[model samples]
Target: MCGRADDHFGPLGWQVLNGLFGYQGWELESMRDEVRPTDPIRFVRRTGAGFEAPFGRWGLVPPRMTLDEARKFATFNARIESLHEKPMFRAAFQAQRCVIPIAGFWEWPTSAGVKTKVRITRKDSKPLLVAGLWNCSQTPDGPLESCTIVTRPPTPDLIDVHDRMPALLLSRDIDAWLDAPPIRAREVALASWQPRILQVTPA
Candidate 1:
C-alpha cells in the first residue's frame, strides 16, 4: 500500500502532469511535499467536457460512508484483483478512473521494523502516473470528492519491498486507461504494470 508520497511539484509539476496526460485543465494552485490518506491531492480525471484537475481526498469515501466511518477501512489503495467486485470501489473503478500525480512513493518492507521507509521512483526521474478510482459524497458542508489508488501484485523488482505496488499507466496508455471501457481499462492496466526501471533507497 502506498501510504505516503512526495508531491512538492508546485505549478511546474502541474504543468508536467498536464503535458504527460495531455490535459490543459488542471487548476491546482499548489501541492504538498508529503501527502497522506485523507489529505487533499490533485488528481486528473476526464469529464464529459474533457479533462478536469480536481483536488480530492486521497482516501476514497463512498457516498454511503461518513467521513469518520471512511477512516476505518484502508481505502487509500484498492486491490486491482477485486476492484470490480468490491462495492466500495466498483462504481469508481468502472467510471471514475483517474491518475494520481506523484513524484515518488514510500513503502515499508515486511522484513524491516516499523521505522523503516523505502523511497521508490522512476529511474528516468519522471512523475509516476498512478492509476486510481474516485467518488463523490454528500457531506454536511457540501459535496466531498475522494479517490483511491489501484494496486496490483508487485513486479519482481519490488516484491522484496512490498507485496503490492500501485498500478502504473505508461505515458502512451494513459488515454485507454482513463477513457476506455472497464474491460479495456483492465487490460491496459495489466499491461502497464510492466518490468520497471526503478530507483529505490532508504528514506
Candidate 2:
C-alpha cells in the first residue's frame, strides 16, 4: 500500500504537467515534502472543458458515505482487481478517474528483522503519475472531494520492496486513462504493470 508520497514537484515538474495537460497556473492548496493519507493533495481530474488540477483529501469518500463513516475503513488505496466489484470505488472507477503526480513515494521494507524506510522514484527523476479515482461527498462544512490511489501487484523490480505498488501512467497514456470507456481504461491500467528502472534509496 502506498501510504506516503512527496508532492514537491518543482519548476521542471510543473513544466511537465503543463506540457501534458496544459495545466496553467492553478495554485495548490499545499505542497508538502511528505503527504500522508487524509492530507490535502493535488490531483488532475477530467472536466467537461478539459482537465483541471485541484486539491482533494487523500482518502476516498464515496458519494453515499458520510465523513464519519468513511473514516471507519481504509480508503486510501483501491485494489485494481476489485475496483468494479467494490461499492466504495465502483462508481468513481467508471467516471471519476484522476492522475496524482508525485515526485516520489515512500515504502518500508523488512529485511533481517528490521524495517527500513526507503524512497522510490523514477530513474529519470520525472514525476510519477499515479492513477486514481475521485468522488465528492457532502460534508457539514460543504462538499469535499477525495481520492484513492489505484494499486496492483508489484512489478518485478518492486516486488522486494512491497507486495503492491501504485498503478502508474506514462505521460502519453493520461488521455486514455481519463477519457476512455471503463473497459478501455482497465486495459490501460493493466498495461501499466511493465517493469521500469526505478531508484530506491534509504530514506
Candidate 3:
C-alpha cells in the first residue's frame, strides 16, 4: 500500500500544472518533503467550472461518517478492485475522483530481514499524477475534506519492492480520468496501473 508520499514541488512543478490546466490559483505554501497519513495534502479535484487544488487530510473520511468514527477509520488508500463495493469509497469513485500530485513516494522493502527505505519517482523526473478519490464530511469545526490514493497490484519492475503501488495517470489522460463517466473512469483506473517509467533507489 502507498502509505507515504513526497510533495516538495517547486517552480518546475507549478510550471507543469500551469501547462496542463493554466492557472487555477493553487497555493502550495504548506508543501512538505514528507507527507504522512492524516496530514494535510493538496489534491486537484474537478470543479463545476474547471479544476481546483485544495488541501485535505490524506486519509479519506466518508461523508456519512462522524468525526469520531473517522478517527477510527483507516482509509489512506483504496484498492482499485473493490472501489465499487466499499461503502467508504463507492460514492467518491462514482463522482468525486481526484488527482494527487507528488514528487515521489517512499516504500520500505524487506531485505536480509531488514527493511530499507526506498523512494520511487518517474525516470523522466516529472511529478507523478496519482489517481485518488475525495470526499467532504461536515463537522463542528467545519467541513472536513479528505482523500485516499488508489492502489493496484505492482508492475513487474516494482513487485520486489512492494505488492501494491499507486495508480498513476499520464498527463494526457487527466481529463478522461476526471471527466469520464463512472464506467470510463473505472477503465482509466485500470489503464493507469503502470506508469511510463519509474526509478526506484535508496532514500
Give the winner by lDDT: 2
Single out the weakest 10-residue window by summed lDDT for candidate 3: 21-30
Write down the TM-score of every candidate: 0.88, 0.94, 0.93
lDDT, candidate 1, equals: 0.82
Colliding pairs, model 1: none
Global lDDT scores for all candidate models: 0.82, 0.87, 0.86
Cα lDDT of model 2 by residue, 1-203, tens digit: 89999987777777888887786563343457799999988789877778887889999999789988999989999998899899999999988999988889999999999999999988877789999999888878998999999998888889999999999887778888888998888778868645866889898
By descending lDDT, how would the candidates be arranged? Answer: 2, 3, 1
**Stretches of model 2 off by over 4 angstroms after superposition:** 24-30
Q: What clash count does candidate 3 reach? A: 0
Q: How many residue pairs clash (N, CA or C atoms closer than 3 angstroms) in each of the candidate models, in the order given?
A: 0, 0, 0
Candidate 1: segments with Cα more than 4 A from true spot? 10-15, 22-31, 110-115
Error at 3, model 2, angstroms: 0.2
Query: Which digits, one per residue and each the tens of the lDDT, describe model 3 over residues 1-203?
Result: 99989887677777787677668554437567689999988889877777788889999999788867877978999998899899999999989999998889999999899999999987867788999999988899999899999998887899889999998888878888888997788788778656449999898
